[model samples]
Target: MAPTRTGSKRLLHDLNQSIVFNLIMEHQAISRIKLARKSGLPASTITKIVGNLLAAGLVLEVSADESSGGRRPVLLSINASAGYVVGVRLREATITLTICDLQCNSTYTRECSYQPGTAPQQVITIMATAIRDLVAEAGLTMQQIFGVGIGLSGLIDSARGLCRVSTILGWQNVELGPALERQLKIPVRVDNDVNTLSIAEHLFGQGREADNFLLVTIGRGIGMGIVLGGAIYRGSFGGAGEFGHMTVDVRPDAPLCNCGKRGCLEALASDYGIVRTALGTDPGHAIEDAIVNLIARAHAGESEIVAIFRQAGITMGIAIANLINIFEPSHILIAGEGLRAGDLFLEPMRQTIPRHTFDARDDIELLICPTSDDLWARGAASLILHEIFQSPIYEDEEALALDDLVSQASKAQKHHKK
Candidate 1:
C-alpha cells in the first residue's frame, strides 16, 4: 500500500509537470533564454521544467540556431505523438469527427449522416460513439486523449457549456458540455460552430496574422464571428454575431424567416432564399436547376434575377458595414457554400458597402474564400488545443494543480455518495 501510494503521488506530480512543459513545446521554439522570457519563470525554474519534460518524452530538441553573440542554442518543440484530442462537429444533417495530435496534425477524419429529425440525445450518443471508435482506431487509450471539443450551429453559451438554441438542429436549452463530459470522462467544450471555425482560421488559416477580422459564413443559414482584440466576442449573452437575423427588408410582404421574422437578411440572401426566389418563377424547378437558371439569367442581363441578387447583396453589405462601423475590423472574410455565386454577389456588395460605410472606410479589406464542410470540425479540435495551452496552467502551475485536485476530490465524493 505504501509503495502504491508513493507511485500514485509521483505519477500525479509528473502529470502536472508535463502539462506546463507541453505548453512551451506548443507555443514557442526557442532555447532556455526565450523560454524563460515567454514563460516568465526564472532560468533555474525553466531548466527544471524542461528537464522533466525531456525525461517524460513530451518535448524534443529540434535543432540549434546560433545567436549573434554566442554558440547555437537548442530549440524545443512538442513531440507530435505525445497525445491527441478529438473534435466533433454536429450539423443539421451531418456529423464530422477528427482526431489530432498535440501539434494539431489530424490523424484521421470521419463523417456520418444524421436524420433531419434526430433528437439531441440521439445525436450526442452518435457523436460519443464516433469519437470512441476513432480514438480506438488510432490505437490511443482514453488516458492519452486530452479532451473533446464540439462545435454546433446555434446560439451557444460557450462559457456555461449550454446551447440555448440550434435552429438547424431544432434544439434548445441543451446542456451539451455536461452531457459529453459525463459520457467521455474528459474535459468538454461546446461552442458556436462559426466562432470555432473563426478561431481555427485565426490560428491556422489565412487569419493567423490578422488581429481583427470578421468571419461571415453564408450557407443554409448565415452567421458571423467577430474577432476583436485577438479574441472571439461572445457578446453579453454569448450570442454576439447573429448577423443573419438582422432585418434587411422592412416590407411586411417579404418572405418569412426561420425565426418567424419577416424580411430578415437570412430570408433575403441565404442559399434557401435565392433558391426559393428562383423556384417561385418556375414552379417545377429544382434548386440546382434554379441555380443554373439564375446564373444564366444574370449572365444574360435579365433584370429581375439581377435585381434580386443585387438587393440581397445590398442588404448583406449593409449588415457588414454596420459591423465595420462599430468594430473597425481590418478584414472581413466571406465564406461558405453560398459563395458559389461570388461573381454575381461581390460587385453589388462591394458597391453597397462603400456607400453605407462611415468615414469612407471602404478601404477595409474584404476577402471571399471557400471553405470545406470539415473546416468546422477541425476548428472544434483547435478549440481544445487552444484552451489546453492558453489556460492558467501555463502561468501558475501550483494553482492549476490545486484546482485539478479539488475537482478530482469533488468528483470522488459524489461517486462515493452514489
Candidate 2:
C-alpha cells in the first residue's frame, strides 16, 4: 500500500529530526547553524526540530561562550537523563541485567542465575522478577524506563520477539516480548546475543566509524555478526551469524562439534574446543578448571597447551580470512571471554589472517574489544536505542509503536502526579 502524503511528510520530518539528533550526538554542544548544515536540513527545520527536542526534554541548551562576539549561537546537547533502558544478556544458566540512561551509561546492573534444565516459563519469571527488583533497587519506576532488550544465543525471530531455537537454553518458540510485556507493562525486544553485540558496536563502539564490519565472538561458542551497507544482514531466517558452524576442517578424524558435526570451525577453534583437545591429549590433566587454567598453562609455557591454542588461532584465522574475502568489510571486531588467553592466542590469529586474506588485506582494520557479561547485557540495551535512533526511513514500524507506548506511559505518569 502506498503511504499517504501526510504519512510521507511525517516520515520525512522524523528522518530529518533523526539526522539532526545524530549530528548533535556526534558533535556535542553543536550550534543550530552547524546542525542545519550538517544535517542538510533548512535552518527553519533545524529550529523547529531543536525546539521540539528542547520542549520534550530530550536535548538541552548548554551555556554558550559570550566572548564569541554579538549573540553567540546556542549549543545543544542530548539530555542523558531523559530516561533509562534495561538490557538483559541470557546465558546457559545466568541472566545479567543492566539499566542505562539516554546516553547508554550503565547506572545499575545485576545478575541472577538458575539451574540448568529449568523450564522456559520459570526462566522468564525469574528474568521479570530480576528486572523489577533491579529497577526498584535503582530507585526507578517503570515509567522511567524506555524499554527492555533481551539478548541470548539462539535462532531468534527478532521481528516477532520469539526465540526460534536456543540450544544453550534448550528453548524453542518462546515469545520473549509478549511474556515480558505482560509482566512488566512496558516494551520489550529480543535478539540473538551476538546480533546485540553487533548492534552495540555499530551504534556506540568501534564500528561507529565504519559502515561495514564483522563482530566475531570467540568463547564457549564462536559467533559472527555481519554488517553490510550500514545495516545488519540477518540472512533469510535470522540465523546468518552462525560463523562458528562453518566447516574449517574436513579430515575424517576431526573433532566432533556439539551441533553433531565434525571439523566445524567451532569444534577446532573455540575455547571449549581447545580445552577439549587439552584434556584428551594429556593424561596428567584429569580435572577441569575451565578455560582459565588452560590459559594459565599456556602462559607458563606448556608447549602442548600453547600448540593447541595456536592451532585454534590458525583455524579461526583461516575462517576470518575467508570472511574478509567474502564480505570485504572494512573492519573486524574480535570480542569474547576467550580473549583471556591474551596475545598467546590472538597474535597467531592476527598474523594468520593476512596470510590467507586476498588483496586489500592491509586496508582492513582489526580491533580487539574487551568483553564481559556486563558488556553483553549493555549491548542488548543498546538494541533499544538503535531502534529509536536509526534513520526513520528504515525504522521498524513495530519499534516505533513501542516507543510511542513508552512515551505515552511516561506522559501519563507525569500527568497523574500532577
Best candidate (score: lDDT) = 2
TM-score of each: 0.82, 0.92
lDDT of 1 at 362: 58
242, model 2: CA deviation in Å?
Answer: 0.5
* Candidate 2 accuracy as lDDT: 0.83
Question: Which residue runs does candidate 1 get wrong by more than 4 Å?
Answer: 1-28, 37-40, 67-71, 281-306, 391-418
Question: Lowest summed lDDT over 10 consecutive residues: which window, candidate 2?
Answer: 281-290
Worst 10 residues of 1 by lDDT: 393-402
Candidate 1 backbone collisions, by pair: none
Error of 1 at 107 (Å): 2.5
> Residue by residue across 220-241, what tens digits does model 1's lDDT show?
6799998987778888889989
The Cα local distance difference test for each model comes to 0.74, 0.83
Task: Give the per-residue Cα lDDT of candidate 1 at 416.
Answer: 37
What TM-score quantifies how close candidate 1 is to the native fold? Answer: 0.82
